[model samples]
Target: MTTFPVEQIRADFPILQEKIRNKPLVYLDNAASCQKPQAVIDSIVHTYSHEYANIHRGVHTLSVKATDRFEGAREKVRAFINAASTKEIIFVRGATEAINLVAQSFGKSQLQAGDEIVISAMEHHANIVPWQMLCQQIGTVLKVVPINQQGELLFDEYLNLLTDKTKLVAITHMSNALGTINPVKQIVEAAHSKNIPVLLDGAQAIPHMAVDVQDLDCDFYVFSGHKLYGPSGTGVLYGKQALLEAMPPYQGGGDMIRKVTFTETEYAGLPHKFEAGTPAIAEIIGLGAAIDYLNQFGMAAISAYEAELLAYATEQAQQIKGLNIIGQAAEKGGILSFTLDRIHPHDIGTMLDSLGIAIRAGHHCAMPVMDFYGVPATARASFAMYNTRQEIDVLMQGIKSLIEVFG
Candidate 1:
């Protein structure tokens, strides 16, 4: 087992100390959501307790303070993804909403009848459904790039799908269901070769690795703050400056308008055009603090530690009889999805929970991938920097007990 500063990190999250059925909590459901550190919790409380005011429409001191904090969070998001400017970052409720915003605004503007929009088989419903809805609305065709049995995208098949008729290609940087880390840089380059713009669903990638939007050259990237140790109900969509300016506004409300007129109303620029009414002021501030907290730890260190944890868990899991791990992508993130012989994934999840171990069991919002694998669901254990080898041992023991009981 690799030695991580697990004790030191565990101390930062108070919720990890709680007991279930008199057993210490072993949180392995990080892919669903991560426990927040004190820094993030305190930041949220501080924002609401000390400075709570509506932003961008008032002249009062509190409003000014709120606006500054809110916009500062935008800058933090820009820096987090290495976006070119704050204008490229638009805050929404979560990755789902951010993706819908782009699909409705940018997609509606770009796609026409018989136009093609490509996505991967491993895409979450949030990434797939929005494009499908848009395609249905505009009479466009939605194409899916197939994945191999190992759950890795078939890049050659993806390349073949790109053509002059392809208007947009939406894909996931990392599969939330399978833990497949896709070659997004190469994917983007290939799509751009055919003049197709790419939108990356980064909900799974942002929390696990360092993402440089400029380096990837993707047209749009979306991720949720909750998955990155920030507050819930907060997310960001980063678009290239030109694309954001060209796309129409998502929602028409108070902040999105430049001037109100019955005859003709002008829309605000880049971010404001997308951000409608009063935003998630406190959550945005907390997200900024979360970014600050992660920066202090250094993303390189976090990535390395999570990779080690994943490898250790994989080795331990492979030792169990009648166990089959899914998504054996050459490049994977911190997620481990698997199944046991004749045992439903939901049963495995419930059994683990009895031992104070948390995991995700379902299609994980990627029903296509599940269908491709011919499985109803999978039990997923996702690790973070705070997870320890002891937790993995507990998980392994829990699985062994389950096998003995069910076998």
Candidate 2:
């Protein structure tokens, strides 16, 4: 196993050195948003400083240069997912918008009354609500695949849920709240067996592990840039070429049309048909820089190091009195969620903040998972590649103090 240079990597993120409440900050809210490295930050600055202009509609020198960088970022997203072509990658605002794009464009055109869409119990609201809205409008129904107590999706039950009426299956590659990594490959294979297209919510999965859209053979995959240590307002939606070509334009506006007249208009090709209005040029370039940074360390090495940290944190956290850990699946990412007996998660989070340890406290945007577990909310500490085992020690100490003070 290759040893990760965690300390060296930490130096690249200036925010990690920040102090909170007179102490060094131990940021454990990675599942919410990862800290951006200097490389990504610089890329944004460089684009605005030297490469600033509107892309794809001008002949000026600045516009040509800016267009190259913007389109180059598209290629970066393309290679990152091993997509067949750049035409398959559509830029959206974030995972939320990406899901909406599929729901409104593809779902509206293909689905009819009494049709079915399958989603899991652990889906983020971004994956759930859009489909619900679409279903409500078209008189369709959503079939939910239940999970076990361990937060693992019941594979057999998922297979049984599929039928000819099922138009699509959407699932999260990793649970943002539980840290459970679902068997996405098998899920896609089963959905394909039924000739039902599958969409994987890659918002949580792409940051922690390697993703190959072609390898999984998923029809659509979406993720946000900020969660991957890039800028906000930028995301990628990877759709199969045939599907993208078949689906109608999402939101019609400028640049999506080839020729416009008073009576007739011709839409542009696959990706441009989906991407309308002025896009996020600088943020997309920053995302490209983030991808370049990830390639340097490789996802395999980062996953291995994070696994070591997760084990250490879990073992130490289990020793805390009156603390109940949630979502103990056989396979997990870097997230750890737990609640204390007779203590609210918000209170625990506030106390941890005084000690400069940041963790998320809430339902984590997955109310269904919380409802299933019978908990209102939980305190979550999710790790990343730059995080260290020493930080886990600090987290344990903080939790131990929370228990003592509450008593």
Candidate 3:
């Protein structure tokens, strides 16, 4: 009986009070992006209203205040993931941009022609596309480890894929569409045995569970703030100090230079070298506030609570006749994806929306996973800390109504 302060958690998110189509909003699209709590919202407002200034290169009062908040956010991110230093935390636009940065900057140098980068079959498009682009440019080959029908990675096949030619192994810590939690620590150990670097896309993992980069021993980790109940256009990329020093700058512009000249320009340090332009300053502060909000409840308790919710949803889902559930990985996060016998996913989403239940429908940016399952799309209901089992019951009722309507 792991207890959770469910009602108190729900009240913190003002948007939960929203009424959609005259029905109360039941938000279950957490894997895409989580709803912000009032703390995060207030932080964003405070940053914009009180301390809005470009970070670094400015010695003015507001600039220093803004830079403190911005860099303070970086420190929060560092502590959140247990990174060694603030130097390793490079704020990017989102997980998409974070992966792109590593691919162009680190992958370019580490991988030559005929080199291989290994990824899982269930990777999101954000994880897959950048490596493909890198391979296309450098003549490197991308290797994909297959997944079982349960959506778990084939570990033996992954081990087989790691040869001397393997340069990097990039994988998602959790599958956004499938909710499958990968064996990342084991994956890192296997890759390291071959002297291969590994990167984790933590966009789906951070909000649901506690993450420690040092314990995982992954060379790089990336996550988006928006998925962690923060704001859009804000993300964090964590790289080892040694790797970041060796890698070239992802982009060259303001704040990334120690000294600039007509002949030879000197680049700045680890993090600034990767961050090329003006960042999402206010959003970064909001992200720090989001971290604060989560810490109050603690991730362990949240994970436990969500597990109970997931179990309830899974058990209830089985009772719906003609409903086919996808991604039955034994160990998973709180995501439920399904397809009704005669209903398109888009229609399912629309019908659910009319009842004020928010769930995602489509390929979910993991077209490869969808193709593997032989489905065009699925309706996904992803849970957050604020979600309730009662909401799941409403969803079941809505789904049953759809079956009756279709019949």
Candidate 4:
């Protein structure tokens, strides 16, 4: 087993101490949502306890405090992705809303009849649906880049699909279902060469590895805070300042507008233009704290540790009889999705739960990818910084028990 302070890391999350069915809980569903640290929880509680007030409009002490806390979170987000300016960060509900915002504002303004938008076969529904809606609204065409049997993107196929008519390319930085880390820099360069803008769905990538939006030069980058060890109902959308300035406001509300009259109104600038109404103030503050927590342990260290865990898990899992590991990408994150012969994924999930081991078993919101593999779903066990090789051993034991019971 690779050396990591797993016990110390487990202590940071209080919920790991709980018992399930008289057994110690082993949480492997970090991809769906991570267990929040005490720091994040304390931040939310502290915000609600003391600094509860509406932001931006009020000039009073409480409002000023609220505004400072709220905008402070924005700066944290800006720095997290290495965005060009605070103006580039727009707070939204989550990655779902962020993609929808781009589809609505930028899609509406730029996409025209017969224009084409490119996406990958491994895209989540959140990334695919909004673009489909846009294509349907206008007469735009939606094209998909196929993935090979190894669950890696066919970059050559993607290149072939690119044409002068391609308006935008919306691709995931990492595949949520397959754990494939895409070559986003190369993808962005390819799209830019065609003069087509690209938007990266970064919800999965941000939590696992380092992401530099400026370095990638993607037109827009988006992620959710909940998946990054922060609060739910809070996410960020980072668009180039020039692109945001050109697009219209996503939602019309009090804060998004600069001046309003009976006849006409003027929308606010970049960040505020996209963010409408009273925002999730406490959750935003909690996200800032979560970022601070991640920063304490550098992303490089976290990535290296997770890579070791993934290799150990892969080697151990391969030793099991009749086990089939899915998505064998040359480059991968810490997600291990697999199937056992003649056992349904849901059944495997339930059996593992009986052993106090939690793993996700479903289509994982990428039905198209499942269809490609000719399976309804596969059991997924994703790891985080807190996960250790011993946990993987427990998972393997649980799987063996499940097979013995079912077989």
| Ten residues in sequence with the least summed lDDT for candidate 4 | 1-10
Off by over 4 Å in 4: 1-4
Instruction: Estimate, for each residue in 200-256, the C-alpha lDDT of model 4 and write its tens digit.
Output: 999988888988999999999999999999999999999999999999988898899
Model 1 misplaced regions, further than 4 Å: 1-4
User: Candidate 4, 354: how far from true, in Å?
Assistant: 0.8
Task: For model 3, give the RMSD to the true fold.
Answer: 0.8
TM-score for each predicted model, relative to the true structure: 0.98, 0.99, 0.99, 0.98
lDDT of each: 0.92, 0.93, 0.94, 0.92
Per-residue error (Å), model 2, residue 281:
0.8
Tens-digit per-residue lDDT, 1-407, candidate 1: 34556677789899999998789999999999988989999988887888879999889988899899889989988998999999999999999999999999988897899999999999999999998899889999999999998888999999999988999999999999999999999999999988899999999999889999999999999999999999999999999999999998888889999999999989998789999998889999999989998888778788989998999999999999999998999999999999999999999999999999999999999998889889999999999889988899999999999999996
Candidate 2: worst-modelled 10 consecutive residues by lDDT: 1-10
Better of 1 and 2 by lDDT: 2
Error of 1 at 88 (Å): 0.2
RMSD each, Å? 1.1, 0.9, 0.8, 1.0
Per model, state how many residue pairs clash.
0, 0, 0, 0
